[model samples]
Target: MRAVTYDSFAPDNARLRCGEVADPKVGPGQVLIQVRAAAVNPVDWKVMAGGLDGMMDTVFPVIPGWDVAGVVTATGPDTPEFAPGDEVMAYARKDVVQAGTFAEYVAVAAPAVARKPATLDWAQAAGLPLAGLTALRSLDRLAVGPDDVLLVHGAAGGVGSLAVQLGRDRGARVIGTASEGNHAFVRGLGGEPVSYGEGLVQRLRALAPDGVSAVADFVGGQLETTQAVLAEGGRHVSVADPRVEQHGGHWIWVRPDGAELAVLAAAAERGALTVEVARTFPLERTGEAFDASRTGHTRGKLVVTP
Candidate 1:
């Protein structure tokens, strides 16, 4: 099988190479997927660079990716949730870091896989799992709802874009932070767009003098901004920075749950959620895909077709 792998952690990502590798093994309660599309995320490159070495063990020649939209080709012993030919999408993080979604085939735990919505194409489906889960988890922590004024930092990026839509779906009046260039894009996602950087707090106060009821920080480095604009008793959560805990806010790390993925898929099918694919690369160009993700300014998700 053709897959991308790195032999060891390094600051440089050019070490990622696409080559022939042995097929992944299907373990108990797992399914083998014939990958159609995979999404590149910041964490993919970070993991490759040893950013997560303290959290998860890595095997040499590590394949690095987690978001996948594919078809089930086989199921392992005791797996009954799916069979051959089922279309699925997953945030397929494994305990070990050997087999991954950046390959022609990946074997993942059945519990992490969910059926892909018929309404979404493979690339869109591939873009949803990890970023959608991050947004959903942060919003869940903040308990955003009607009567709340919710603020989303980095609202034009992958997770932030989804957070804007999800907040609006929950009846919150969402104020999304983006560059001046992306203000219109954020508004299209049902958020009141606010330009990021200097005077952000002042601008937000002008929009809601009473202050925002919740803040979802996808970009981090905004603890001060979150504190300044949050109303009394307001909640806050972040996916990027752990220091949020010091400010009485939650720091979220998304976990793979088939049930949650199914809910997101249903929302996509119902036209309540959407995934944007800003660019795509063939499997052989996985290195370029990672390079694009490292830029950290893409308006939407970057996908790789295998």
Candidate 2:
């Protein structure tokens, strides 16, 4: 098996070095997936940079990828959810390190894997699991609805794009913050776009005369601005920093749930959800993929295929 790995922590130490390693075999209650595509999330590279070291205990030489889409070549004896040949997608775990989708194959716990939507290609399915689930978890905390006004910061990025669409699907009048360049793109998804910059507060007020019923911050900065703009009792949630809660906002963290993933997959199948792959790199170009992910403000998720 060939995998991208880092044996030590450094700000820019991540690399894709190919080596002959043993293939992963299924374990009890696990599924061995022949990985098709692996999506790059900011979390992946953040971990690579060792930002998460204090928060997690792990050995060096760990393979790091959270959002994975692949096929089940084998399954654990105790698991009943999937069989050989099933197409699946999963968010592995926060603590236990993953062999990861960077490899040609990896073993994932059955509980974490769900059938990929028939409507999505490997790249698309691969792109959505982590970002989409983070968006879903954030919006779930907000509970915006038909009469509500929901604002999404960084609305043109992968999670923001899906959050805007999901808020609309749930009947919220959605407003999203993006630069002028992405206004039309955000509008196409049913979100009213507001320019985000120095005067973002004024821009938002100008567009939503009624007031924002809920604010979801996908962009990690100027959270005080996002918080101040929310309507009275409006929920402010983020997938990023939760300390904003101290300033009268809510923080959201993503956890793996096959049930929620199944819902997302079903929505994608019904044409209610879509994924954007801003870029795709072959396995050997994993370094390039990590570099692309490091570039802040990518329009959508980037992917790597093994």
Candidate 3:
């Protein structure tokens, strides 16, 4: 099968190339997917640059992606949850770095796969898994509720956009920080928009003078602002900042869960959620897609169609 692969880490992504590689072997409790679309996240590029070497082992010629939407071609024995021909999406992250979604086919553990939302096309479905999981997990950690006023940092980016909507869906009064250009976009997701940096705390205070009841930092570097605007007993969580823990906030790393993926899919189906695709590239152009994600300012998710 054709895949985007890198044999070694390079800061410039110079080693990433598209070429034929062996098709993955389906293991017990796994399903092999014919990938229709894959989303590129910062982790993909970071992994390509060896940023995660301290965390997980990497096999040579590693395929780099976790977000995939595709059709199941086969399921391994004992995997009764899905069958061949099922349309699915998965945050197919594994314990090791290899056999990723940037290929024509990916072998995902059944526990990590969910039926793709019928309301979303391939690219949109592909974009949802990783970002949606991160947003959902952070919100869960913060325990956002109807009585709460919630703030999301970097609210117009992939994870933050979903966090905004999810906060609204959970009945929180959602406030989000974005650039001036993206204020309307965040508002469309049912969040009140505040521009980030310089006077951000004052801006948030203006929006929620009583103080915000919860904060989810999808963008890093907002610990100070989070500390400033949080209600006395409010909760806070960050997917991007490890320093959050020092301030009595939770730090989150998203885990693959098919059940939670199903919830996100159902929300999209109900029109309560949507995934934004800023740009898409073909499989051969996966390196360019990685470059786009590395820009740190793409308005929405970047997808790769294979």
lDDT of 2: 0.83
Ranking by lDDT: 3, 1, 2
Residue 141, candidate 2: how far off, in angstroms? 0.6
lDDT of 2 by residue, 1-306 (tens): 887776766677444465656787778999988889999888777877778778887676767688889998998888888999999999876455546667788888787788999999999999888888888988888877788899999999989999998999999989898889888989988999988778888888887766788888887875777766777777787778767888777777788777889889988988888997888988778778888877777888899898
Against the true structure, what is each candidate's TM-score?
A: 0.99, 0.96, 0.99
**Model 3, span 72-109: residue lDDT tens:** 99999899999999999999999999879999999999
- lDDT for 271 (candidate 2): 86
Question: How much is 10 displaced in model 3, in angstroms?
Answer: 1.1
What is the lDDT for 73 in model 1? 98
* lDDT value, residue 102 of candidate 2: 77
Model 1 per-residue lDDT tens digits across residues 260-291: 99989989999999998899999888888888
Candidate 1 similarity to native, TM-score:
0.99
lDDT of 1 at 212: 95
Cα RMSD, model 3: 0.7
